[model samples]
Target chain A: MLSAGIDIGSRTIECVVIEDGAIREIRQAPTTFDPRGQIENVLAGVSFDRIMATGYGRNLFEVAYDAKTVTEIKAYGRGARHLFPEATTILDIGGQDSKCIILGPGGKVQRFEMNDRCAAGTGKFLEVMAEALNFSLEEFGPSALKAGKVLTINAMCTVFAESEVTSLISRGENREDIALGLHLAVVKRAAGMIRRLWPGGPIFFAGGVARNSCIQHLLEKDLQVPVIVPDNPQMVGALGAALLLEEGA
Target chain B: MFGLFGSATPNSNERYGMTIYDDHYLGGIEERVIRDTETARAAGAKVVGVYCAFTPKELIAAAGAIPVALCSGSDFPIPLAEQHLPRNLCALIKSSYGHAIGDSCPYFRATDLLIADATCDGKKKMFELLGRKRPLYLLQLPQTSATAESHAYWLGELRRIKVILEEETGTVITDDAIRKQIRLYNRLRTIVHEAFLLNTGPIPLLSGRELDTVTSVAGFELNLETRIAEITAALGEIKERDKDDDYIASVAGRPRILLTGCPTTNRKVLHLLEDCGGIVVAMESCGGLKTVGGLVPEQGDPLKNLAANYLSIPCACMTPNKARLDLLLAIIRDYRIDGVVELTWDGCHTYNVESFQVEECVQATGLPYLHVITDYSENDTGQLKTRIEAFLELLN
Candidate 1:
């Protein structure tokens, strides 16, 4: 039997199809204002017996496609455990939100915390700061890794941090140093959320933001723990959903 | 004098395949209440507005006046209130003050007098400003309810407010009148408490929103007998529906949630919780179990009895608020609650700080607990939906 899972997020859409308990195909698309059209585009040729949806726009997908729905928290917990069988904690910094999940024995979600009603410490924050610094998203993380001394960016708000970034640029500050500071600010907020949950063992980092090497390196340095980023980090939610359907969970 | 008769319609939840009996006879009473308050005022009946649960409603009734709750629970007037108040203040305080100064709340416009208390520093200072616009009377409440001196001081405040009520309404408030009002209010509390307890069944007969609507709308009712009759009728209908086996089967198996914290006047969080698939079986806030859990002694001096009963409420304003924790644990067990969700408004320092102790106490019971700190805004609905859904998943 084959199962399909789709994650319709604020920034992107991911579709994962699995057969015989292994990933068969993975597809992705950018979710503009017309997410329904984007969703149709991503799943044009994928075929599966059972399908599930998860993420910010999962409800819309459920209504439009008559599919089952699960929250991203449960999906991440299941997905991370499937990839690394011994994993007990997971962090996902997506487009507009970040969540830290602590799993109990058998991969049941024990406790979790998410950023409240803001885009301060997520991929959206990085995207905005990258634009303000005139750096492409692909080069933003690699550029930040080259900085020597990090300048402090105290404001975590996206709007305020953008203005702060502009001021730092005007002050003849190195763009690389300011970029590193912005990355550190995001890492600081994410670390605070993880620490509050009292996580132990290795942290399984997923979602679009996990692709940034600077955030992963800074997170390890700040928390003094090993951070694991899976390949195709953005596909974790969709992969988890498909895997959960296979297990009938 | 608000008309009590209205067309009643039962709200159906298609998800559960059941029809929830709606006792919404009290809906749309605001305009009628305003018009009625005007007519009654012209006929020499006084209307007393109050902001906290500490003020004795019986005293206002005994003085031949109507008691209306003036605490603001909306986000509409908050920006207007921010012109004079700080933007960082509690939304409840800001909304209440905004309603008074903006001349928007019909209830505030109808009140001949306003009674407030020193529950917290924010509310106390805001009341000072509110006094400038209306005939406001501040009740000097004792900080601690665990002392004999505190009880005496509270009794003195009640007596002082009683005198003010009499002077303002030009009515003689005798001990007999006080006792009569006490009996009437005690009955009202008993009936309302009984209605709230119906949710303790294996399947709740009324949803949380329905329970909230019934209790809050009933407060606008000035005629005690009519209010009691309407609620009693609604409760009876619910009980009658509970006897049906099919009705019970459809609503069963949802996680039962108990809400505890600041007054859930805005109800955004409450709606979100239910919409996320958890039934809020009990609420321990001011408008819920906290204010209605106890009754005053009928045989004692009325003012002292009122003081003792009202003082014993376990608000976070008290230093050693063990009573609140004790009440929470008891309700958790009695309601068979599957989880606890504590809602605290932003800048409500007392409840905000008290949530730490509440979390520790709740976790010790081996049940899941979630503490939501928010303001009266819809900006966080998406985030709140994810949190609430995830919390409910934890229960499963």
Candidate 2:
């Protein structure tokens, strides 16, 4: 039977459609304040035999869709295993939160550390940094790569990051390098999360920001490992939801 | 008030301007807050009666007790406590001479009875630390708004308060009495709510630094009705009066990130945030906001005011994380928050598992958030500043 997983995050809503146990399609959209409306909108073209929802807004959507809801930790664990089957630590970074999930060699979640209360290590921080730099996020990595020497990006808050970025810009620093500096700052933020969960490495990074080349290069450099992303990185959680539901069935 | 279970002595020690109790002991926290022989005297205070120095003595009147937070002698440094707690533990708990090897707060030393709330884990420990000194009237509160159980739990605690106060102090709490206190609190909350509302809300922001001075008054007796009146008046007078001056933050979990998890809120970190072009308008965890609701329980039953108060605030540990998130979210939304900083204390269970989940929720709003892990000691001030500046720079 076909199953689906819906992840309604704080700033994004994602859906994964699975057919015959192989992932079929995944879709994502900005999570609106009214997640119910956003969920309805994101799933307009999708049909499913069974549905499970997850994330911070999991319960809200469960009540709306009358669907089974699973924790993001469960969904992410399943999704990460599918994407990086041999990976031990699946670091899933979303818009507002980051999860450093530990997996046994069997790919089940052993322990996980979640940074949900702050935005420093997630996509939202990147967007804020991107806006501050006045460069499309597409420009972030390449520009950062060009920096001869990296200037320090102080201030972890998205609000203050913008001000600091503007100051850096006005200081006549190359915008690209500054963007790289911000990327490094986020990497540093992620590192703190990584250390706390103490997931021994060979880590796999996932999330929408995983598509960004700049972040990929920077992250790979930071961890000194070959970083990988799923074919459709955004739907990893949704895919896990469908997978988890199927397993239970 | 004099005949309520303990000895009452009206003799004031001239040097300290306190009613010295003859039986004051020096072995525990309770003995430090109050001593025997001075139960009715105003030298000692109940912890519950004072959430902050700025909370006002009217709260004491409403709660039917004197609000005396210990503020004497040295800043009691619990080597173990200081090892774990942020420098932000309420000034009263840290500043008093009470945490000595065997000494309790003289105010608690003198008092007949008292009340305290589990607003923070440290304060909860204070209940035990001081309880060893005296049986503290407990409020399992100052919790976050997420758990429905909190409301029920708090109302129950308040009910216990009503019964216990009635039995112990020989003064039963009536619904009318509670409603009367509620009205006063509501009025005060309204005023306080209004104070944060002035300047179109969340203006004239005080740093955690400046606000610490206000919280230092938490150690003062809540019966200083005059002080409450003075604060009310002073708040009204500031032209740049910012009703929304939320400076406290609860930074939870570990990783030695500066200024994260609940620090009992003090001037230093608040000063740090403000100095870094940031303001701690809200807490990412149960750190700063627990004191807001622990003042009175507001559940369906007025009798369990204490419990009700505890259950109403925002906490991260409860089942329904939404209510807790919403409470902090409302503060962020209301305070016009520019950014959020997460403090992860080194060895907390409930928060460490879900700290990132909390970080994700806040980040989803497109707000600026930073995560720091610390052992919550004051020793690593410089490294914390560098990280703070770096995090602030990220916002630019």
Candidate 3:
């Protein structure tokens, strides 16, 4: 059976096509304001028996495509468990929000916590700080590794953190240490959210932000647990949506 | 006077057509509140505004005063409150105090007397600020109901209020008058209980919003008989419609949720739950099914009975609120609840602290429980929807 899943996130749209329960093709593009048109363009040549949608803009395409909409939490959990069956806890830090999900036996969401209406510990927060430091988002993690001394960005608010970063630069502090401090701030906020629930067993990290090796390493150090990242962390939600097609959702 | 018959829903032409009730009869009561208060005021009746259900409404009624509730759930007064209290205080308290101090709420202006219960620390201080701007009475409630001493303390508080009421109205509160008011209020409680029991049906005869409106309106309406009649007639329509079991069977499969939380006078979460495949079968919030419906054992002494009835309400302010947990478990069984959703309003320390106990109680029954901590801000709508939807999927 051919099944497809599309994730219309705030920052990106990910399309995953599965054939006979195997991932056939994965594609991604920056999400446009017109999500339906963007999704159509991304999957122009792709065909599937059933289509499912999940993410911030999931509803925008649900009626247009006659697709079933699943919560990003559930979609990420399904995708993570399928990739790493032994994974019990999944932490997905996306553009606008971060989520910590505890998956129970039978892949059920036992419990979960999401960052409240703030962009403090999310990909957007890093994007803002990266812009302030004149570093590409992709270079943030690699540059932070060169720091000798550790620093902590106390303000989790993106705007406040950017000001704090500017002040650190004004004080002639090491740029690498400031970048590392910002990463630590994000990891600390993420750790605090994860601690609210029982964070037992292996932790799987997914989402667009999962590509940050600095965040991945800091999360492991702060949490005192090994973290696992999928081969394509960003496609987890779309992959999970495709997997749900067999369940007749 | 706002016209009642064939009244079009305000802003019905706008997006979301904000109707108070699906039933026209009960919806009429929303508009009738202002008119009813005006009529009572014109008839030389003193209007008493109450902050919480813990204040004995029957006592105020027995004093020949019309008792109306003054709690505001809208965000309009919140900015006004920020001028007085810090923005970090509980939303409900700020809303009430704001409406009173800002001079925006007609109910607050019309109230001849305002009784503010010291249910939590936030309100305890907020009411101090409110007293400066209005004719406010502060009732110090005991934090626990387990001991005889606390009950006696509460009983004395009620006696003190009765004297104050008598002084305000220049009329003595006789035992006969008290008993008469008790009987009438007891009848009103019976009707509220019947409406609550309607939720236990295969498909709830009343939506959480409708039930919340009726119960909250019960506190504000001076005429208990009229409100009782309207609710009973509305219940009749429901029974008539629910005679078809097919529709009930279809809706019965949805997850039955028991909502216990910070005073949710606003139906935002309740409507959202139903919108996301879960039906709120029971609520234990202030002015909700649990606090508003329980009878005041009419056989006992009127004063003691009223005290027991008020204190019997297990608010989060009380320590070791086992009665609340017991009541929650009983309703879970009676309503066949599939899950429990406990919502703690932002900065409400008492409810936030008590959520642990409520979670343990719900978990002991082997039911899934979701603890939603939120404020009145619209920013969390999508996040909350995702949580509720994911929870419903887990239930399935």
Candidate 4:
């Protein structure tokens, strides 16, 4: 049997096709205002017996593309567990929000917490800070690693934090120090959510922000626990959507 | 189709997409409120506007005045409120203040006296500001009710309110009048409690959203007898429909959720949970079953009865809210709730802090609990839906 899954995230859309419980093809693209159109080109020649959708725009896909909808939490849980079978907690930081999901024995979500209507702990926040600091997002992580001192960025609001960073620059604060402080502030926000759940199992980080080495390092240092990042963390939601087809079939 | 205020006609079902079933239980609820208020005013009855549920409604009713809840759940007046109050206060507070200053709430405009209970810090300060525009009475509520002296202090405060109501309305309130009002309110509470019991049945005859709308509307309806009769008839009709195959299939085996947190005026959060296959079996928020939880003794001194009931309503503002925890455990067991969802409105520092303690208490029962800190914004709808769906997935 063949099945296809699509994840319509805030900033991106990912689709995966699985045939006989094996991943056959993986494709991704920038999410457009019309989620269905964003995936139309990526899914040009792909067809499957069933199509499932997950992520921010999952609800839109059901009526627009004749697909089934699953929440990103369930999709991420299934996808993270598939890669790391022993993972008991999954921390997924997407473009606009961050979340922590506690998994049970069968990879079911026991409890979860998400950033509350704030962009401080999200990728968009980092992108804005990176632009203000005149550094590409790719250079944000590695540059922070070489900082001489970690300045404190107390303002959690992105706009306030940017002005604070600019003032810090004017106050003769080192650029590397400001970059590291920004990374620390973001991770601190994410960690606050994680500590709310205080999951006792292995922590596996997923989502677009998990690719940042600085965040992963800070999380491990703050949590005093080893953090695991799966290969292709951004595709976890789509992968989980595909796996749901096999679980029920 | 006359509005509760008796000035405007009720909107058509097509405009609200209201089904016949919705109309049966909750049709023209706001209209009924206005009509009830207008009828009471025409009869030379004084109208008292109350902000907190902890205020004894029977006391105001005893003074031959109609007690109406004045908290505004409307979003349109929030900007107006922000002009006067801080921009980052609770949405309900801002909305209420805006409605008062902007003259949007007909109920507030009709009120002869406004009673504000210092339930939370934001409200306590906001009421001081609102006093500039209206005749405001602030009732001091004791935060810790564990001591004998505290009970007496609360009783004394309620009596002072009773005196204030009597003075403001120019009516002498007899003890017999207070006792009669207590009995009437007790019957009303019974009616609401029975309606809540409908949710505990194997197949709930009413949805949580419908139950909330019905009961919360009852709080505003000065004519309790009519409200009770309508609710009783609606439940009877729903009980009959509960046997339908499709209705049974729709609700059966859904995740049973117990919502405990701040008042959810906008029911989109509840609807989102149910849409994701989670049936809300019970709620402990401000507008939920707590509205009916104040069951005072029918045969007692009016002051003591009112005092006991006021102190018994466990608000998150109270330190060491053990009563709330006990009540939550009882509701969870009685309703067979599978999970608990605690939502704290943004900038509601009291409930936001208490949510962690609630989480700890609920987790001790071995049931999964999810704490969602949010506000009345559509931006977080997808996120709230995802977290609730995942929590339900844990139960299944």
Q: Give the residue spans of candidate 4 off by over 4 A.
A: A200-202, B1-36
Local accuracy of candidate 2 as per-residue lDDT tens digits, B28-58: 3244334323444444323332332222233
- Angstrom error of the Cα, residue A106, model 1: value is 1.0
lDDT of each residue in B374-395, candidate 3, tens digit only: 7776778877888888888878
Segments in model 1 whose C-alpha atoms lie over 4 Å from true places = B1-11, B14-24
The segments of candidate 3 whose C-alpha lies over 4 angstroms from its true place after superposition are: B1-24, B201-203, B217-219, B240-242
lDDT of 1 by residue, A116-201 (tens): 88788899999988988899998999999999897999999999998898899899999999999999999999988998885577
Chain A TM-score for candidate 1 is: 0.98
What TM-score, to 2 decimals, does candidate 1 have?
0.95
For each candidate, give its TM-score against the true structure.
0.95, 0.47, 0.93, 0.93
Q: How do the residues A27-74 of candidate 2 rate in per-residue lDDT, one tens digit apiece?
A: 888887777778888889787888998777776776677887666766
Write the number of the candidate with greater DockQ, choosing between 1 and 3: 1
For all the predictions, what are the DockQ values? 0.82, 0.02, 0.67, 0.70
- Residue pairs with colliding backbones in model 3 are none
- Rank the models by DockQ, top first: 1, 4, 3, 2
Q: State the lDDT of candidate 4 residue by residue for B272-318, as single tens digits.
A: 77767777778888756666776778776877978887787788888
